[model samples]
Target: MLRVHSENELQLNADVLVIGGGPAAAWAAWAAASQGVKVIVVDKGFLGTSGAAAASGNGIMAPTPENWDKVLSERYCLGKNLANLRWLERVIEKTWLSLPLVEDWGYRFPKENGESVRQSYYGLEYMRVLRKTLLRLGVQILDQSPALELLLADDGSVAGARGVQRQKHCTYTVRASAVVMANGGCAFLSKALGCNTNTGDGLLMAVEAGGELSSMEASNHYAISTAFNATVTRGVPFGWASYTDEAGNDLGGYINGRRDPSFLPNALLKGSVYARLDRATPEVKAVIERSHFIAFLPYKKAGIDPYTERVPVTLVLEGTVRGTGGIRIVNDSCATKVPGLYAAGDAASREFLSGLASGGGGPNAAWAISTGQWAGVGAAAFAKSLGASAHERVVYPVGQAGLRSQSNTVETFDSEEIVRGVQAQMFPLEKNYWRCEQGLLDSLASLETLWQQVQANPKQDTVSDVEFSRRAAALTAVARWAYFSALHRTETRSEHIRVDYPETDPNQRYYQATGGLDKLWVRRDWIKDAMSGDKPQNVKVVTGAIDISGKDVGAQGIAPLPRLSGHAQLISGDV
Candidate 1:
């Protein structure tokens, strides 16, 4: 039954509720709804137009027919230190299956004279196809409704979520047997260069619900960043770029004849990085335009060829996409430790491609399609397994008291001021590309203070003010998590370079970090071949808990997580 409390408030029922309307949520909804499950998807923006998938610079990473062996080796075994090996294998396999479906739905990959061109980043086309597929399959999408918290039953199993409808200024409850936390990553604090809503909402929900986050310390993503734009990071892979200082000296070294993500940091040492493609062959330049020419499109609009001049770029702290550390899912199932809960896309710790490397041209695109479909099917199966519980229903009590507010007048201060303070504190060397013991400690102390200041105030005087408060709170949690995770890792690994440690300790791989704001720590049971005797008894490492305080959603009388063996419970079969 479609139960409406009023036009202002809504009480809906769904068998599977997929939060966030990105590729992950869309695929999950399609799978669940296609299987005759009632699925509802909620997002902070419009369905097809919202999220990073709608942005340019995303591709499917897979082995070309001729280079399958070499590409597979590079993606999984020999080239990168992958945590989920089987998961990566499945991703590659699923790429072949998913690509044809996307093509059928009208996603045009670049083609030249009847031959399909590779390295095309599907942005707008990808999201449109996904949204159309969901609508055709009867999946209900609720845009402009950002999920605020996860709703739990008597037991800890996920029972849907509570979110605010943007225009309505009202709260709604979605009752479902299973929930998919595909709300995406936490890069919004990078001034919307990433998705504007990528502020760790799903991460916050997972932690309060007792789920663990994995490999979070790997920070720093090289992008076409500057004073004005953040969207150009996606366009860098297919452009002719340069790095020069105030003196106009070339600083970027050839890592396969162009700038690579890893090399961007060093490129910044002497000067700023710039995208210069006006000098390249027309084919390459054409591909750049087709991909997301906005990097230099401004120059073109100004009647100046980009190659004639240089546009500056820099690096930023990021999660997912270019780095790791997200909700840990087992194998290729996308199922977490909590029953009826699954994570996909950037929200999950893919750990497929190793540290600091982004296999976006092909790998990341394949991951979004593959894992999303699997998670959808997995969530549907979970809903089916609930038996009578699957059909169980209750009109959850919704009220102003049940929800958290942004400002409390007395507790709240200026949101913009705090945001600027945070970004400034993070953009510097000590906590970013150049991390050290003292610098990390300094970063942690300052963030902790900011977190306390924010927590002391939770009031919403206006809609924008509330939005600002929510964004600030979410960013603070994400930043604190990243800093602590980086501090715990004692070795210089990939993008997570600890200058003081400076060496990639082989023994460090035996254990990986996983924790929440309540207690920051690491566990080793999941690490491959990490036996108890793997390390000598003489070594000492800090494993105690540190409180990264944010607003306590736990005040809602949330249930503690139950013990369940991951992978063992996975009812796996390709979707």
Candidate 2:
């Protein structure tokens, strides 16, 4: 647990403390303040840009009734109904409402005849709407303030957070009755959170303070083009592909090497590729034949030649999806199992599937707005119930010593070098379209060794060097978790290809796992159980249950089985 300091240690008391300055944080702070609750928003970067949403070009995709129903059904079916249905419904319902709220705050959307036009499968226009809304709200925005730790009360409940304001060389703590962890997922915090940027800090804070996390193991993998190093470019929608030959011939056939175009229209539907392809048509077959179409099934999964042939083609980029399974929430009110804590946007989920629709004015941004607004209002109300005395207490600015501690302890490294290493490891041997148990094991071992070496010799100096160390730590954590998780799942599903376990077992049951649960013991059987699948006794229900006699589980019919255990705690070894 992070050490706590007195009120003199960090300054500023707020009714609601909102971490992150993304669309979610913006709405959260605005919503809380609108209720006349004192609020503060702390961000790791500049308010308008940075964070995951800033990197995202396309906004959330809104789901039509038919498409929405299909996506929801797919989530339930794939997740085996482990998902929280009410939360899903609430996200879908409030999406449209959130869009207009942002616009009313002064942001504009891409429109036709003054009405927003849907673009791509997920909406990409609501970004503008959010930007304008933030400016009008008068939120107390603190850019480039990355949170260091959760400040806990005497009883260990979450009170606020401690962080370093990089430019000031000082630590700042914003005390609050309730804190909303809208800081995007741990992708950036990979070193700290491990695998993906979800270091599970927010979840960890909630859990440490007696909150529970559900559906931690359900991550989504996106279909990125190998030839382009996954550089996403916008064009026509994903389902409607534009086929071209080396000579740039506009073949009279459709793009995307699938046998059915019907599923292409349903690309807007939120389901796995396997489910979408199951609804393919004969015309798609003709189109593939006519175009001499090469099947580019993103990275890894295409057979020998399909995997080897590095073809150049333009991607009709659709907006981004979580790719990781959606987070789990308990109710329509956006509350988690914990009382004073709330989560919104991608941070809270079991399904990991964001409820954004496919076209413009999509559901992604709308949900961020809606859920964030809800969390903010809820947090404010809860804070208010604590009475005016709570607000009377003064919050002190973080101490110089704490600031130095964070700056001196946090680590950062060469991100470019790490990215290159990750690409090389993922593409060639470990992530080959055809993965094998042996190859995966070998790759994981190598990654583990590398991580050990880095940890043993982690650079520690002054505050200025904190970022590098932090980054290095995050990268190692992410690599280790992803590699271990990939290695642990013995079956072939969705993006997890196992050459040895080539066929998807019809009766295999899937389970979801969360990390950092107190019930999980590092010294006892946790790690060993996870590696061997012994801990997931509850997952027997789905194993070997499906019938795949004549079905194509490889090319289609594959979905990611949940990892039934949480993350392994990091151990330090001397270099």
Q: How do the predictions measure up, each by TM-score?
A: 0.83, 0.62
Candidate models: Cα lDDT each: 0.63, 0.46
lDDT of 2 by residue, 1-575 (tens): 12322234447788888876667777788788889877788877766665445544444545655577776566434433223344456666666555565556554556778777433211223444454555566557677776655665554445777676667755677778888877554433222101233333344444444543333222323232323334433221224344334454433333475434222223323221211122235676454323222233332353423222323432122111232322234444466545556777655542323211121123445557677888888888878887766644443322111122333334533434544454454434224334565554555555554444343323334333443444444434444444444454466654345667766543333322333321221111011111123223434232111111211122211123332322223221100
TM-score of 1: 0.83
Stretches > 4 Å off in candidate 2: 1-10, 63-85, 110-132, 135-138, 186-321, 325-328, 336-339, 350-367, 388-429, 432-464, 483-511, 517-575
How do the residues 393-444 of candidate 1 rate in per-residue lDDT, one tens digit apiece? 4424211111253245454556677777677666665457778867766776
The ten-residue window of minimal lDDT in model 2 covers: 521-530
Error of 2 at 117 (Å): 4.1
Evaluated at residue 472, the lDDT of candidate 2 is 44
